[model samples]
Target: MDSSDFTCVDVRRDGFVLHVVLDNPRSDMNAIDRAMHDDLTKLFRMLKQESQARVVLLSGRGRAFSVGGDFEWFRTLRSPHALAELNRDAKQLIWDMLDVEIPIVTAVHGYAMGLGTSIALYSDVIFMAESAKIADPHVKAGIVAGDGGVVAWPMAVGPARAKEFLMTGDALTAAAAERLGLVNHVVPDAELEERALAFARRLAEGAPMAVRFTKMAVNKLVKQALGVAFDASTGYELLTFMSEDHVEAVDAFLEKRQPRFTGR
Candidate 1:
């Protein structure tokens, strides 16, 4: 409830809408690091207890909604203990987001990649900027699209289209994403925040119990999908964390070069 309780994420209240900003100071691009990841998990869990909050408007503070996972943090997952913690946190974050009864409206801009894309996809409504791009580029990092990506993308765009983008780690423009039904709306980059916030405020002003129950009912389908696939996908992703190819991919990403994967 209190913004002071979090370090990486910024939380504030505007009337009945809770404004949650992904503002990781460690990355100008707002990449999800360990701190941000943990903060998000805690934030969503706390949302359930906030009596005054009726809706959540989630966005980013920098040039990006998020550029996916921090490669520096990825390096730390090489250890078994770290990977186990990641697996737990990844699943908990997605589950908590789904469990929260409040409707979440996301305003995505710049780049929303990997976990970032997953977060946006899970929201009840998504508003993407015209110049912004979205992608689940876990494959490019030599990892599985396990953290909500596997569950959300296929549901949004269908399995065939999802597989194409997920496997190739291809980026989709706002228009393309809209065409695929991946996002609810696309606005000019400048108007992204205003439009998304307006919609969130509208949701907030609606009949509270009716809105909350509607969201809860709709999320049953998502929760079913999460139950069916999330654990297995994340488990596979953790296995990939120990792969030689994952090591090369992270190395190349940081070194600014193409990874030479040997399928190890």
Candidate 2:
């Protein structure tokens, strides 16, 4: 495995399968920071160049899969321009994850919140632990659910459920999410990775063209139904990053307290 400043992303190959683990540790959950984002972008680019890579299994290294955007990373940015750049970086990461050509399966456990939830949702298939919690808490942080939520949620679970989740900033249990069609399956925590890898290997063993084409066909339909909403989400999320409320939200989270947002 190679290393970067954000060695948070660890990549390894076994036969035809690529195993990628998110390894950030500041939070029990691996919250995405700029460095980690860059690493993931690089990882995907490498994957895109690999004609022999048949499957990808994405998982987190710690107790929680991911807790979303890094609070400390947000706290360090004080300018509208800087915030916009950060948002774009994050948006691009999600878009790459969605548009990548290979068959990808995500194994989620513990917390999958904010952008983390979006990552899981965008995967070709998601296997989550029953103990996992997935939430789009961007509204709670005074930002739009821009990263993956608005682009993917309504398509996966219907517009009404999408509205409720984004509006309320509530966490959904893995079982609830599966029942609502947001996740593919919910298994025991111990079984999450095993199940996901097994599924990925199965896909990898199949005819590559058939699997890739089927995934592409379905994704095209989703993108068409969703229109250019992803572009809109990118703009809105960056705009919110310019807000005083956004900074305050990050500060509050880092300080371990409720944010007293002034809606600036």
Per TM-score, the best of the predicted structures is 1
Q: What C-alpha lDDT does candidate 1 achieve relative to the native structure?
A: 0.92
Write down the worst ten-residue block by lDDT for model 1: 43-52
Q: Any residue pairs clashing in model 1, and if so which? A: none
The top-ranked prediction according to lDDT is 1
**Residue range 1-264, candidate 1, lDDT tens digits:** 777989888888899989999999999799998898889889878877778889999999989999989999898889899889888887888888888888999999999999889889999999999999999999999989899898899999899999999999999999999999999999999999999999999999999999999999999999998899988999889989899999999999899999999999
Question: Whole-model Cα lDDT per candidate?
Answer: 0.92, 0.81
lDDT of 2: 0.81
Question: CA lDDT of 150 in candidate 2?
Answer: 88
Worst 10 residues of 2 by lDDT: 1-10
Q: How close is candidate 2 to the true structure, as a TM-score?
A: 0.92
Off by over 4 Å in 1: none
Clashes of each: 0, 0
- Candidate 2, 73-121: lDDT as tens digits: 8766668778667666766676566567888999999899987888788
